[model samples]
Structure formats: structure tokens, C-alpha cells
Target: MKLNIAFFGSSLVSSYWNGAATYYRGIIRALAERGHTVTFYEPDAFDRQKHRDMEDPSWARVRVYQPTEEAALAQLKEAAKADIVVKASGVGVLDEWLEQAVLEYCGDSTTIFWDVDAPATLARVKENANDPFRELIPEYDMVLTYGGGNPVIDEYTKLGAQYCQPIYNALDPSTHHPVEPDSRFSSALLGFLGNRLPDREARVKEFFFKPAQQLHDKQFLLGGSGWEDVAQTIPNLDYAGHIYTRDHNAFNCSPLAVLNINRDSMAATGFSPPTRVFEAAGAAACLIMDYWQGVEQFLEPDTEVLVARNGDEVTAHLQNLSVERAKSIGQAARARVLAEHTYSHRAEQFEQIMKAERTSRAYV
Candidate 1:
């Protein structure tokens, strides 16, 4: 059955500073391919409008709007007509108002609160008993998260979510595949790409900075925003400011082994896998990720991807890096992602979830 889905998200066209653009593009494109109509509504904020990398994606109708109360209400009214109206997390601003407006206006549509940062959202609600989202949780038809696995599911359920499911981040093989390593990044012993957020800075310090300092003999490349303010005492660590999404393939393939470090909240939450994991895997880059609770569920440790708990472990991986072994691990990870963790797979799972929800609602 064809469905009309209206999504309120961070961005679909601009990866400028938006982390979820790749995810939105991959999933929405797959949904459109499956005969669904998708309308993505993004707020013009954080210079996203100025730095739009993709103006017109054939898969979805991209609507950029101002965040005025009047505009929001009007958008909410229009979005209410869809079969599914998704209110995604981290819209950059006015999250509370948007959540309330979506729930209030999405008349007969299946309202879904899709939390891309489930751990942070849950942590906020846990800290404040009177948080509006706490009351809004039960009202939504379903709650979907990009990560947070069973722990997130249980917490949402306890907080009176009618239904909760994790739609984990997946690779888009077409967009992110093994590419010829760029000479610029290929010389680096290790590389990491992420915006410096407060929640993740300490972990970056622990897992990334300290390790880079210890491995001063080897070159380390860091890319993303906010590092300009960071003190670059480590002589070997190169800061490539603000990398574009288009460069992800080169960024992944260039490094001998890419690093994956979770935000502190996500690390504590255990099952959350960042998008970088899949992106690196898709590029067939050897990955050495900081250990988390459900690392085994997504990729096998020590074989498909190497796991590290501390600076010592990360240093050991760097110290023991062999070209043949790294290639083997990268290839295995690529194969695993292609088979089980692609956007096509995620789109199918989303279809199944929607079908099951519809069936359950019919019975009710």
C-alpha cells in the first residue's frame, strides 16, 4: 500500500552541521522506491539553508520553512493530512513547541516521535519529572529511535510509550562504498570525523586525544566543526575543519584504521551505534571502536571490527596494525553491512513495523 509520510527533521538537503541528513536521505529514498510519498519539512536554522548540499532529491519533496509559531502551526496542519507524520528529535530549535504542535494537529495520522538521539532525550526526561515529553510519550501512536536498543525500548515503555522500536542506523552501499583512497588522508595512521558536542568531548579526549598523543610517531587526522577552538598540543594530530558529506568515502578509505567513539550518554546507554560505524564499514575501512554493551549485535568484536576500552587498548590496536589483517577486517565488515545493515534492510523493517502497528490498531 502506498503511504504519505510527512517528516519534521533537522535537514534532508544540508549536511552542513546536520548529523542526520545521510540517514534521512537513505531511509526516505528507500521509502520512495517502495512506492511511498515522502515530504521532508526542515527548519531554516544553523546556516542550514545557506549551505544546502542537496537542493532537490528525486526521492522526496523537501520543504524548508521558518520557525515562526504561525509557520509551524500551518506546517503542522498540512502535515496532519499524511498517513504518517514523524516528529524527529534534534530539530536544532523549538523542539518542545514542535512536539506539542505535532501531537495536537496530526488528527488521524499515525504520529511517530522518532528520536535520533534517544539516549540524550531519555536522559533529559529522567532528570525532569515534569518534562512535557513525558506526558506526550503515551499520546503518540508509536516511538521510533535510531539507536538505544532494548534499554531504550524498556525505558520508553515504562514511561507509557504505546509502542517503541529501534530503527538502527544502516549503510547505503551506493552512497558509501570502497573508493580509491585520497592521497591527502591516506597517509594518516588514524582518522575520526565528528562535530565536537559537549556530551562527547570527554570521550573524544579519553579515546581520541590521549591515544593520538601516545602515538605521536604516527599521524592522526581529525575532521569536523568546533575543533578550531580545541588546543592542538598533539603535534601529529591534523585537524581538517568541517568535512562535507561528499568526502566521507575518501575520509573513511584514506585512514589505515578509523576511530569510533560514542557520546558519554550513549556509552552509558550501551546499545547505541553511531552512524560513523556504518559509514566506515561501508568504505571497507578497518574500524577500531570504543567498546560498548551491544557491540556484538551489530558487528563481531576483534574480527569484523576491533574494540577498545581505553587508551591502552587503542594504542595496542595502532601498534599491532598490519596491512593484510586490516584489509581482512575491513572486507569482513563491508560484507556484513551489505548483507544485514543497509538502508534497503532498514526500509523493509520499517514497512513491517508499520504493517504490524496497523494490524494491532485494527484489532483494537
Candidate 2:
């Protein structure tokens, strides 16, 4: 049966400005490829004029919503007709009341809370013990996490969620693949592009900044927002500000090696590889990642990726590794991602999960 799904997510689908939109486009397109009808509902809070990437593809239908009660109610009415309703995490436009209202409109359709940031969400829930939504976990049919392995699932299940699963991040080969290296940023030792992670700042310093400082001959580039005022003793570290999503491959190619610093929550949860890992790998750039529990599961150490335990380890890799060896590792990682991790693979897993849910409901 062809399933009709209502996907409520943050940001305009047409404007692939953020990482969330990239995720949306990948999964939604994959779903469409599998013969599913997806109606994407996005709140127009951000400026649509500032779209930094490609326009919406022809596969999925998009619906824009307003903040008013009438607009939300109307969208809810339309959503009720779908076989499944997925309220993605971090729908920034909707207020708390609207989120609750959307959940309440589950009415015969399977309601899934697709949490993109499980660590942050879990952290918030833990901090707010009195939050009513904490208890609302059990009400949803299932809770889906973008990444975070067994630990995340166990935590969600313990928090009263009926079922929880990790979808995991994967590369979109169509968008990210072996690209011609950009010569401008090619001489840099390490390049990191990620938003502010307060808890993981230490890890960033240890694995990235410190190493760049130690190797004064090598340059380090930092991309993404919220680092203008952060104190940096390292004169070699260059801030690139925010790089657009479309230009990510060039940014990755510009650096001889890219640095991936997992947020503290993601590292603690385990098996949570961010989108940048796949993106960098897909771009065929050597990746130096901070040590994490499930690092081996996604990328093999020394073979597919270089594992950096501390600033010293990072510096050692930068100084010891030749450009030829780094390129070989990058190629291997790209091959691994192309074979095992992609949006198509994720879509297949999603179908299996939904099928299980439907079958179980039928028996009940």
C-alpha cells in the first residue's frame, strides 16, 4: 500500500538553508522514491528570500503554515487524513501549545516524534522534571532519533516512550561525492564547521585548536556561526564564519583534513555520528575525529578514519601523515559510505519500521 505521510518539520523545505532541511530533502525524497506520498508542512518563520541552497524537488508536496490558530487548525485537519504524522524535533516556529495540539490530533494516524537532536531533547526533558511533555512520551506510537545508538533508545524507553529507534545519519551521494579539491583552503592542517556546542568546546579545543596551535606551520580554519568573540590563543586558527550548505563540499575539499567534534551529548549517547562526518567522507577528505565510544562502528580507525584521543594525538596525525596516505584513507572512507550509508538505505529502514508498527497494530 502506498502510504500518505504528513511530515511536520522546521524551516521551509524549498529553502535548503540548514542541516535540518538537507535531512528533510534526503529522507523525503527517499520516501517518495519508495512510492510513498509525502506532504511536508513547514512554518515560514525564517526568511524564504535567504535560501542558500537548491529549491524543492518535484517529488514531495510542500505546505506552508502560519502561526495563527485558524492556520494550524486547518493544517491539522489536513494532517488527520494521512496514514502517518511525523512531528520532527526543533520545529522552531510552533509554540509549545501548538506542539501539544498537533500531538493531540493523532486521531487514528500513527504519531511519531522524530527527534533530530535526541541529546538536547533528552537533556531538556531531564532539566524540566515538571514538564507535561515528559509524560506525553508514552502517548506517541514511536519515538525516532536521527542518531544515538542503544543508549538513546534505552533512555527514551525508560522515559515512558512505547518504542524508540535510531535512524542514524547517512550521506546523500547525489549531493556529496568525490569532488575536485578546492586549492584555496587545501594547505590547511584541519578545518571544522559546526555550530556552538557548549559542552563539547573542550573536545574541540583538545582535538582541533590545540593541535593547530602546536603545529604552528599548519593553518586551521573554523567555519559556522557563534565564534566571533570566543577567546582563541592560537594565531593559526582562521575563522571562516558560516559556510552555506551547497558550498560544504568545497569547504571540505579546501582542507587537507577535516575535524569532526561531536557534541558532548552525542559522544555520551554513543553511535551518534553527525552529518558532517558523512559529508566530509563523501567529499573524499581525510577526517580526524574526537575519540568516541562507537567510532569504530561508523568509521574504521587508521584505515578509514584517524582517531584523535587528545590534542597530542591530533598533532601527531597531522605531522606524521603524508598527503598520499591521507588521500588513501579519505578514498576508503568515501567508498564505505557510498556502499553502506546513504539516504536510500535510511529510507528502506524507515519503511521496515513503519511496516512493523502497522503489523503490530493490526494484531492488537
Candidate 3:
């Protein structure tokens, strides 16, 4: 089932302010490993190219285009030639134009709209009856997502998608694994690494900020862009600006424990676990996620992962957490993800689904 895959995504070489970098890397790399050819078409916007953390990967061809509607449509035309053309959400440049344009090239290629932020997209569609993307949902051959399990799948189906699959975030072990604890990131009792976004700021205030305020004796670390101002507001919290994918292992491992807080829409939508969860677990760091509905699907609570419902519970987990316990839980999470949640496993699932789809289409 070798196919030429053209993936239209954000930045593939950088993780600067893009949270989906790891997710895109894991899936694309694994797909390439399975004998698929991938050409990653990304717009050269948002300074991602300027702050790129890695070279163009050997597994995929990297094509950087100008960040304009004309340039994007040119790339879109190029993408239409591939066996599977994927128009991922949040390309950050002329997104609406690309979304509609890809559908216009529909007959020859297997078109897919891969939504990295399904809950947000669904909410926007539900809020506005006349959103253009909502009307275009069922036009794609298939729909895939970052996470959101059944909740997302059901919504996409209701919107008339012929096929919908939730590819939950999984670890790329080679990229993120246990590294020697570095002093630059050390001495933190708790650490979190995510860009400060509007929908997530309030949750961060409740989970990350308030916990740091309550546990003044403990060291706290915050990483990512746009938190420089907020970082100064907390005395006990250290701000590590823009943690790159290369340093994610140290960011996850140096702390006593790492926290995963879902954005407002994802938290409300329930089954959506962001890439940070798997990245921390891949680094063999003890993970404590803000409680969401599908926690048990990936890892068991209190054993593989600690579920925190509120700031008080997060504080309680930190206070009662022993070094030995942290090690045990970290190891358990690492083992769990490696066995059932690695990118290789995810790639196989994707390949199988595509194979099934192709087979069914052949019958027709």
C-alpha cells in the first residue's frame, strides 16, 4: 500500500510557537517509514523558518512556500497531484482559501481534512450555521484529527464526512526519550511547556498559576512563547521561553513532575489529549494531567498517570508524591506508551484504515 502523501501543515522544521510540530513529525515520519513518500508543504510565515530547530528530515521532503494566497494555491495545486492530499487545519496562511481550493481538486486524489484542533473547529461550525468549512465537511474523502476520540468522530460523521478517524497523540520515542537531567531545567518541582493561547490561558491560570501560588516552597517552571510577562508575575515560577522539540526531553525529565492541561474546548470535548502528554511520558517523566473523560483509554489513573481535577488536587499530588513513586509512575507511563501509543503503532493504524478504504473503494 505504498502511496505518495502530500501533507499540507504548519512548520515541519520548527516547534517555535507551533504546538503541532511533534504531532506532525511523529505521524509523517512513521508514514514514511512504512514505504510512503511524503512531501511536507509548509508556509514560510510566523518566523518558524527563522527559528527552525532541526534540518529537513530525511523521511520527508520539505517544501517551504511564500505565505500568500497565490503561493499557497500554487502549492495546493502541487499537492493535488499526490495519491493522498491532506489539507490540515491551521496552516496559518490563507487557510480558508486552501480549504476550499483543495476540495475543488477532488476527483483524482483521496482528499482529507486533518483537523489538529477538532473541538475548536467543531464549536465554530456549530456556532455558525453558515460557516463555509461546515458545508465543506462531507466533501472530503476522509477526516482525521489530533485527538477527541469518539466525540470528534461522531461530530464529523454528523457533518456528513464519509470517513472519520481520531488519531490520538502518540510518542515518537527516538525524538523524545529519557535524557540526562540538565541543570538549566532542574530544581523545578513542577514543569509545563505549552504556548500561552487564549482558550488555554484561563485553564493555565487555574492549574499552573494557582498551584504555584499555593505551593510557594516548590519550584515551578513554565516554557513556551507569550508567557514572558506572566512569568515575571510568579516569584516561584521560572520562565523558560520557547522550549524547542530538541529540548523537550530535558524539559520533561528535569522536573520532579510534569503537568498536562487541556485547552478549554478540548477539556470540555473530553477525549482530546494533546502531544505534551505523550512527550512527557516518552521522556519517562511522571505525568499528571488535568482530569479529562478519556484518561483511562491511554493510561490508567493513579498508576500510569495522576489525574488532577483542580489546583488543590494538583498541589496534593505534588505534596504527597515521593521520588520513588515518581520513578515508578514514570516508568509505567513510558512502558504503556511504548507498547500501545508510539508513532509506529499510530502509523500502522493509519495504514490499515487507508487500506480498508482503498479496498472498499475498489469494490465500488
> Quick one: ranking by lDDT, best first?
3, 1, 2
Off by over 4 Å in 2: 12-17, 46-49, 68-70, 231-234
Alpha-carbon lDDT of model 3:
0.92
- Candidate 3 — worst ten consecutive residues by lDDT sum? 98-107
TM-score versus the correct structure, for each prediction = 0.98, 0.93, 0.98
The alpha-carbon deviation from the true structure for residue 73 of candidate 2, after best TM-score superposition, in angstroms, is 3.2
lDDT of 1: 0.91
Residue lDDT tens for model 2, 1-364? 6899998887534333355766777788888988999998877666642553556668888887785677877888899899999888887766465557767776689998899889889988889998767977888889998888888898898899999999888888887776776665666778988766577688877777788778888788888767776526667888877777777898887787898988888877878888889988998889988888888888899999998878899888988888898899999999998889888999999999999999999999
Which candidate leads in lDDT? 3
Clashing pairs in 1: none
lDDT of candidate 1 at residue 197, scale 0 to 100: 91
Residue 309 of model 2, lDDT score: 70
* Each model's lDDT: 0.91, 0.82, 0.92
